[model samples]
Target: MHRLFLCEKPSQAKDIAKVLGANRRGDGCWLGSDVTVTWCIGHLLETAPPDAYDPRYKRWVLADLPIVPEHWKMRVKAKTASQFKAVKRLLGEARELVIATDADREGEMIARELVEHCRYRGPIQRLWLSALDDTSIRKALAALKPGAETFSLYHSALGRSRADWLIGMNMSRLFTLLGRQSGYQGVLPVGRVQTPTLRLVVDRDRSIADFVPVAYWAIEVALLADGSSFNAQWRVPEDACDEQGRCLNPALAQQAAAAIGNAASARVVKLRTERMGEAPPLPFDLGTLQEVCSKKLGLGAQETLDIAQALYETHKLITYPRSDCGYLPLSQHGEAPAILQALGRGDPGLAELLPHLDAQRRSRAWNDGKVSAHHGIIPTAAALSLDRLVGKQRAVYALIRARYLAQFLPNHEYDRSQADFTCAGQALRAVGKVIVESGWRRALPEALTPGKGRETQPAQPLPALREGQDCAVAGVTLKDLWTQPPKPFTEGDLIKAMKNVAKLVDDPRLKQKLKDTTGIGTEATRAGIIQGLLDRGYLRKQGKALAATPAAFSLIDAVPRAIADPGTTAIWEQALDMVQSGEMSLEEFVGKQSAWMSKQVQRCVSLRISISAPASPAAAAPWKKKRKTAPRKASASKGSAAGKRAAKPTSRT
Candidate 1:
């Protein structure tokens, strides 16, 4: 073939091939007139294991703790070796090549690694696509960017990969050896990102375990105004309340409750009413989608990602599923009319919503400056009947669709009223809310609506009353409650925590760095990281709550503080960003990382670790065991310390 299009996966290759009219299938590729499309099943090659450099290094020893490679090697993954051979052959024949991969650093690495491995030096270009629909494919094809434009992304990815390998290979061996010295038989796998992520859960579990609930009291008074009933809460005096305004003194609460009950009426001392307007929420970024799905549908983070991936790759219903940006590109707003029309035709349930939608009306979600490589996950013009989707998939699709529809609706408006009352020398406060306009809220599906817990109480339209008006005191309730401990991280909550880790850091400079980069792992890899922890027995799920296992606590305590500190990892991430921006060379970044790794190994050589034995031999250790001839499947794949596919290196942070 004179022209070649290389893709990240078989599904992606097929989509591009269909658009290019490359129907005739060749070995491991599709072919059309002078054009061929081929794919890699994730990375066809992985970073060579430490043993690949020197056989002696295969044996874990402290003396060989930090094995920094002078020359990194890439080996074809055994499972996909055949595909690699096919791609290599195609590269040899093609005159010009197009890199058609997912539009991200990981995707860039997947295609670039193969080009370097196969030694293809040809005129090259990049097909940056956010969606696989025919129109998207054509648009990208017409505007192919020169390969040099994205060459820096490959270097950035390589830096992240080598850094992960440096840490994973050295620290895992060092810790596993230390664990053995302490009579702990299981492997202690430490990651650049997973280690810190595990630390987050471990820290949360500790806080929950160490929490001490304090008793508190609250009083609610029911009041009647012109035969309408509403509730007002007792406002405790500053001296009798805590910082959160909760009454800590039981005697004070009882006295207030009795006074309110005895008083026949409460005089309104102050009344204030204001209208509030809330703009529609931005569309789903992968992290936000995962968070909402975990909270609403009780799905795991990885599960949500899988569903979204299917929607994008299989159903072709949404744009890129792994986007970090939640804002739509201003250019995309012009396509809203077509997408809205498609939605109305595809789902009969949306027929009622169609009338309310104003396609020309743009919301704050459309901002070119805020959009990144990929825009928000939203429905494409290729919408189909919703009946074809079931359960979680349908639910998630509805959420994406609802958010898009909301952008064309007016703001949700409401009137909030606060009334301060005096009853028997005690202060009382009543808050009331009345919906002035349902607006964007009307477009949300029932599943997306606020739950009863979030509602707290039904909206009560306050009766019209002057500041000095008196309302009858109907009844009083005294509540004896205890301050609750922190709730365990659900998969969704953990995702949010991972993205917003800057808030957890104490150092302002480091916190700002974390914010500059994505918090812990990339949006594409966080779910995988969390899943990896659960798979390794470090995190156990109790219903929807994620609790750290005993082994997790031991590992966190045993590791160097910097290894488990999210801020340190986030700083590494900032360095990687510098590499991407061409501020730092890859060689310099790797050298610094190697020196750092050596120091970490040297410092922990003599320390002993205390960890509980694994519940089972299989789950105990993925590293070496004294008596066993073979170790169980590795806690993680080789070089994937982040608990994700190494081909697409997750930011070690």
Candidate 2:
């Protein structure tokens, strides 16, 4: 039987073809002696527009507010129609087919949707590949999975796509028509994921704008012991502070400062030192990687994902770049030494650390149970020079390599000393840390302190002293400061916020569900969703931070509170996860979403609502100036990271 393979993209197809000896190039495909491999650019078929159902949908009208399709249809893009035809032709000729796409929900949809569209009736198998390396491909080929095992993934992805269409199409049209009546001619695009995300930024801006600064005071004392001085601060009693640990009573601070200033000498009431060990951090999940890159490298979310994808597909330097898990499988441990050796050969400077590289060390990162779908992104044994990589690619690769190197090193050990002093009838405390062993911290030069803020205080070793020892009080100072407002969302902060949205919620059940699920969006689509917001002018970039536009604020206020609440995202994801596990049928999930969309439209059709931009401090939210006074409208139906979809690279075809 002629077995045919379908891939997600041309580069991925080329990689698999090289291993299968598929040298001859056919139209939009590669042909070997017995096997053929064809690819979809990203998605070959998308959900049909409203016009496909009825001719009058081409014109925007209020009566066509809730456009729910009775029978969903898939439409081929005019740009990629030829390639779709080629894949359809290949499907017609094959006796059986193999789905060799990205090992994720969107990847499954890209191949399965085409199969359904072409009406293919043949036996099918799955090539679930996490990494495109030759060894990984060959191993997967030897153990092909029955297609039924992964059929649920297609249902889950299809559910997300259909739900997006229902919300995006119906809510967008409803709101745009409403806005036009108010004399604003802008299309307001909304999604299950985007509305809540916009609300996050808008809410933050409101808090910043309304915040009033509070004054606080702190007293710092310099203590002399054995001719060496260490810094300590006066401890505020519980009676003098508020619930947030802020010293609300400035008189208490003044009294403590006066007491210290009058003291001739201080007695050390207690001194204790204890040893502590810190384990190495796990490798980067895509969210963490995007976060760190946005903070350190000054790259946008899309830019970081694009660079990582290039490293995985174009250079073959790293394993799959779209992994959500920050852990490795136990089976992958054996390949570490070879990868490290390759790294050493590629960069001669790494020779110093090669002797310490241990593949046998089982850190917290290597666990079979923790890994799902794909393991963490790490370097491959491709043996390529570092000079070939671009600046940002090299920076990201170096970070991934550093995390791997840390596993082999010893635990970062330190000695922490806490000292208590009583001076002029006031209590004071100070801490000093000494490094016992550099350990894994030496692997990354940036990791030198036991805690992140510990470096601000110098790590001088404490002098040998017993309890009740006397020491001179060198100095005392009282500093006054104002409470700062919350900073606006940076791209990194936004990604981290999106990934950990459970913290924002107050409900116990939804919080637990969000924890089980990966926040608002999957690793593959978070970038695309954020990019879409910026491209659609709902969110604008101001230096290094993000601010919502006036239209965004207006939409958030005009829509029903259910659509803008972060808790709604968790509920939707719970439904999607259930569908993926076969606990709920795809039709049931889509039916529920469509019903929700239709209800929202009907409720808001004749409702009168005011649209006002959320006010914010100019320094924090720069987009507040872009706020336009939109006219009041009589009635209109209103509208996560977005659902899992591939973040197309710069070169998709």
Query: Which pairs, if any, clash in model 2?
Result: 193-640
Among the numbered candidates, top TM-score falls to 1
Error of 1 at 467 (Å): 1.2
lDDT tens digits by residue: candidate 1, 389-501: 99989989999999889999999999989899999999998889989988899888666764435334466788887899999999998988777766778999999988889
> Model 1: runs farther than 4 Å from truth?
450-458, 615-617, 623-653
- For residues 423-450, write the lDDT of model 2, one tens digit per residue: 9988887788888987787777563222
TM-score of 1: 0.94
Q: Write down the worst ten-residue block by lDDT for model 1.
A: 637-646
What is the TM-score of candidate 2? 0.91
